[model samples]
Target: MFNKWINEPKYFNKEKETIIIESDAKTDFFVAPASDYLAHNAPIYAFDVQGDFTLECKVRPDFKAYYDAGAMMFYVDEKAWIKFAFESTDIGHPAVVSVVTDGASDDANGEKVDSPSIWMKLSKKDKVIGLYFSHDALEWRMVRLFQFDVKNLDKASVGLEAQSPAGLGCKVAFSDIKYTDKAVEDMRKGI
Candidate 1:
């Protein structure tokens, strides 16, 4: 029921290839390339998930732009989705743990720490979806929780995205992607 929301996939055509989809602009499909040293954009992948599910992926940023973002995306149209990422402007700058929803951006910038690997785990249970993040694949933090009108989540196809507008062609690598109905209760309690 949600497949119509996604457009054809676009690839980077590099050795560590990645795919980009043109989401329906009318539904909230847009990507912000790095505008300056202060901002880098996040890409969204639209889906219609209404039940308990989990999406996890690995991301490696190639450039050092402020707010350089990479994360698993859960898009409701174009204006709505959840992005969990590690962003920083430079090497000396602390990486911020951030999230954007309903066109509003919030971050745990002061809680910055070193994380070589990042995973975003989104779960839908009882009409509410929880957004969580982790480092070292073990400890997870509850970044936020929200509700959406999603119902046919399982039928949705997740997409991979990377945006490094400032570094023009600065690429991010994504791997080990998995979508399942696995229980994330333990992760939630630790948050």
Candidate 2:
């Protein structure tokens, strides 16, 4: 596996098999609509991936503020990317959040998770991308299923991200990292 960072974090380390990233204050990767707001400073460690693949990891975020997250990212440049995150939400809950960016971001908050750490899965097959979360890493629950198309998509970047949009800083730990070249047969089932 190749290690590449889009935006280098303040601190990062590999503890045994786990990757830890410390996000800086007010760092994010969002492009808001109708405003002069664009944040692409959050740290992302990624590698080039082609064809179809599934990447899954167990993430534990030191969530102290709203929107602090540990994320699985599928990136095709700064304007076209997708982030599926286990995020601390504004409503005082930890939730599954997704932001699909095609020039501008379309953010959605999904199921609330009552855990400190959760398993996140991202799978890509053709033009379809699947997002799922799990408690035990066996039975995954669907978070989002959508179609995304971009130029040179087969050579896109697939990896991990750490963001702290509204806080001083956040530290996220990602473990049990697994990647398979084979994509899931069923997007809804995430099999």
Candidate 3:
């Protein structure tokens, strides 16, 4: 999955330096911030694992500003999608965890932490989708869960994304991105 998206750098390129998936142990894409909104318009593709699925990755922002955003995204099309990201407020403000769905933005709902290495986990069951974040890998706190209509869920491709609209560059790394089906017994528990 990484190879397919990694090879198509043109589709994910921003106004700054183009991103490339390196051959070493570090699996990340480096992008310079866009002065215009052209970078924000590109959609990150992912294969849909809609039922009881979990997607998680680590992100580090390269700058300190309001729109220095980075996170894993599930895009249903160019216009319909959700992204849970962390954005800093200049250099002195606390970094916020935010969610954008259908082009509307929401405030952060998790606890406060410093320059924290964060992980976002998004799970879907039926029409409801749940978002969670973890400071440590073991425990997860719910951020927000809302309902959305993703037109074509089964054909979607999942991947990570980062954009700095403040004309500064940020690098985001994604690893351990896996999609799996819920166990039959686990599904039966709901009934």
Candidate 4:
């Protein structure tokens, strides 16, 4: 795992390498900072990104409240970021969720998976960003694709994120964390 930035989690065990966060009341990372009500702060365990890179993690989320999720995020700031997660639903089922905030948060919901543990991967090549998820490590599926405006930013932040948008807090275990300085050979292939 890469080193975590100053925005660390609430409770972290260095020996076990476990992270636990107590969600701040009404906290999330969204845009429309001027007038929109969706913006709330969450702990972002960030690491700097370079030219082209790929990062993956296996996350098992304990969904205690609505919208609590384990996420992998790429953030330029509050105004621009990509959050790909498995979010807890009100219907008692979890769904694959991806929210790209480029001024405004475009929250998109993907196919629901039955498993509590999910695998997520994100890659960036120049300005284009790709999001993907997998049931098993062998096969990966695309979640969404978009062009992030920032390019050649030597220190763009990317890392694990946990948020409980509507409730108190949640538990998220992120293991088998993998980070590589090189970009995926082909973004379309999702290698």
What is the TM-score ranking, best to worst?
2, 4, 3, 1
Pairs with backbone N, CA or C atoms under 3 Å apart (clashes), candidate 3? 45-157, 46-156, 46-157, 46-158, 47-156, 47-157, 47-158
lDDT of 4 by residue, 1-191 (tens): 45764354555443355554444544466564356566647777777877888988787878888888888888776566788888886667898888887778877778888998888889888888888888886688888777878533566789787778787776678876788977677687568
Pairs with backbone N, CA or C atoms under 3 Å apart (clashes), candidate 4: 27-40, 28-40, 28-41
Q: What TM-score does each of the candidates earn?
A: 0.62, 0.97, 0.65, 0.87
lDDT of 1 by residue, 106-163 (tens): 4344345566546656666655667666675577777666665544444444444444
Each candidate structure's count of clashing pairs: 7, 0, 7, 3
lDDT of 3 by residue, 20-104 (tens): 2211121122222223222334224345444556566555555444455566766665545566766555545445454544534
Model 4 residue 22 lDDT? Answer: 43
lDDT of 3: 0.50
Q: Which pairs clash in the backbone of model 2?
A: none
**Candidate with best lDDT:** 2
**If both were scored by TM-score, which would come out higher, candidate 1 or candidate 2?**
2
**Candidate 2 structure lDDT:** 0.92
Q: For residues 1-191, what per-residue lDDT tens digits would candidate 2 score against the true structure?
A: 84799899978999999999989999999999778789999999999998899999999999999999999899999999999998999977999999999999998999999989999999999899999999999999888898998777877999899999999888999999999997888899787
Model 1: weakest 10-residue lDDT segment is 20-29
Task: Please report, in order, the local distance difference test score of every candidate based on alpha carbons.
Answer: 0.48, 0.92, 0.50, 0.75
